[model samples]
Target: METTIYHYALCVSLTLMLFFSYRFFFGRLPDSELYRPYRQSRRLMGVALLELSANYMVHFFITPRAVCPTIAILMNLCTYWLSVWLFGSAMMLLLDREWVSRRRFVRHIVGWVAYCLITLVLWFLLPSRVSLTALPIVLAIVFMAYAVRVARKVFLTFRRTIRRLDDYYSDDGAAYIRWMSVFTYWAVFFGAGQGVFTFVPDRYVFVWIISAIPFYTYLYESYSNYLLLYEKATDILDKSNDADAADEEQQTAQNPSQSVADNVNCELNARPQLVMSHDQEVALERGIKEWIDKEGYTVGGLNIADVARATTTNRTYLSAYINTHYQMTFREWVNMLRLDYAKRLMRDNPELPVAEVARQAGYLSLSYFTKTFKDAEGVTPGKWCR
Candidate 1:
């Protein structure tokens, strides 16, 4: 009865794996250049899942008692290593594309090859039963160590990237980094669970099946989130491109000679703008300040383009104006406004929670808001209020 139950669970897990693997390979993946790395990672994950399912099927269903234990052990070891290789490749591409070059990829391949060759030679020397039973435990321990190391490295890199950004709420690059961090954490958790189950194959087969349901469910949900994020990123890019094109056309229509000069200056000098007369500059600055004051746009994910659109100005001109008048980049200027607003909110409603104050101040993340507040004011929001 126990064997029957385990067999049924394996069948169900295998079916689900195959279905998702098919979806991953043939599903409507995002076509935007921004999603290229994400798409590649999904493909690698699909291949790994397929190999893992095959490994389980062979171990449970195909390996008969008459079959040589050495052959079964070797096959399982190969599949285990292959799955790890595929996952590691996917993560490397996702977290650090620069590190996924041909040289690094080849190095990884060589390392895996050497490990497998050494293990196989050892397997032949050991008794078949010992090799079958003990080798998995050794491999599981090594894999768990690798997973923990990789997870820590990925998390630190992600945290550093976020800290370096002035306005993470509006930066898609920051969002991608955060998402990769979540993926790394999820993969490590599930991979560790699977590794632990490998040690107690007799007692944990049913538990493994139950755990796999949530594991694959989370995997699918993350894939959906990736799709949604891709769509949003592409939409933002399209709008930015359209806005730039429209701005150029309007400028050319209004002042053909000045526009031509500006284009030439932009190509040669890297920062070209029609010299704004004092009156024009003041008017633009006033318009921006009034719009921000009235609309509270600074409370959330404000960008130069958004402000430019609100003020009926070009983004380039608006950015330059902010830089010249405020002595800061657009991001810094927005954060300055947000920080001031948050301080006032805290002072007026002292009873409100710091998290609520952060939200009202347009911060998507409370931890980030606190860090920014401390950087600017030398005290946390809670401390400042007191």
Candidate 2:
């Protein structure tokens, strides 16, 4: 009866988390921001669902079983994967920041290495026996150590970022870091308290009940973050609408010369040049062409955030803009540009090797470029070059 209740609670918490995760990446995106995090989030969601399913099955139905090796292995794999996901998220957040530096990257690498080492040790130490008793003991110690390290780094980074924030910002969601910290603590606690039932079973049940509280809290916090982001989007749209109206009125009242300026601004603010209402993707394509021809910029070794910064925008905003304008995500947009450039360059330089052409056309990964080009152009770079 008690185990069933715990399973129910876990399921509810995971379900809520999944819902909010979807809402965060999909539901709230404007046309401009649709492709970036949304694309990545979709991939992450698959991983997350697998992880959650494995975790639940092992913890509920097969906690002491040796028969279900599949679920057991999945649980072990997912434990590592969860940490990787968290680390990746933190890296993405930091990479998105304007102030990301070499030192920060170094620290991030160090933190990731430490996490990997700890996870490997834990995996080795994990008992071959299927009882919850030995497993939790190992999990608790390992999680506590890893959680402590992560907590220190995350809190320090969060504090630094918060201090750099403006005194009054329309959008402030730094509070999520606090909730994440609490969740980390709870994860460690739950794993640590797994064996306490031997001494006092009822007390252990209460500990589980306490642990469920934080899981619920974490899930709710995720939902709240998504809600806040959605609200912020609505506010921006409202403000933009008001500004558009005010501009129209001023344009109506203006003389001919001033009206020309208004017209230019209007064109700039018009629906992004695409089939859809507005698209960031089209704008990115146009921007890439302009940079190559006019400014001599290169996309080699470039990530999405780098492209965003080059365009004087945030990645989310730029991603939405590209999606709205060109109907493609940053990844698609970048590959398209690279492949296009490679084709033109290869045609112009017939003597050049396909790999050289790819490199010259700003592709960091030759194999990746070849694969993407084949998908897009229906021919391999080498074959095309030939």
Best-fitting candidate, measured by lDDT? 1
Candidate 1 lDDT tens digits, 75-133 = 55556566666776776665554655778668767876776787778778888787777
The CA lDDT of each predicted structure is 0.68, 0.49
TM-score of 1: 0.60
Task: For each candidate in turn, give its C-alpha RMSD to the true structure in angstroms.
Answer: 9.7, 19.8
Cα lDDT tens digits for candidate 2, 1-386: 25566567656655654564555445544455433443443344444444554555555555522344333433443354354444334333431332335675467557656755664565567665633345444544554465455455555555543322211111222332344455445543443233232124421443443454555446446535644454443343334345435544544564446556556754664322212123544666666566547423244645444454466543434544656557765556556666677778888888988778767777655776677788887989778777
The candidate scoring highest on TM-score is 1
Q: What are the runs in model 2 whose C-alpha is more than 4 Å off?
A: 14-28, 33-50, 65-139, 166-210, 213-386
Give the true-structure RMSD of model 2.
19.8
Q: Which stretches of candidate 1 lie over 4 Å from their true place?
A: 63-77, 128-134, 165-179, 231-300, 303-386
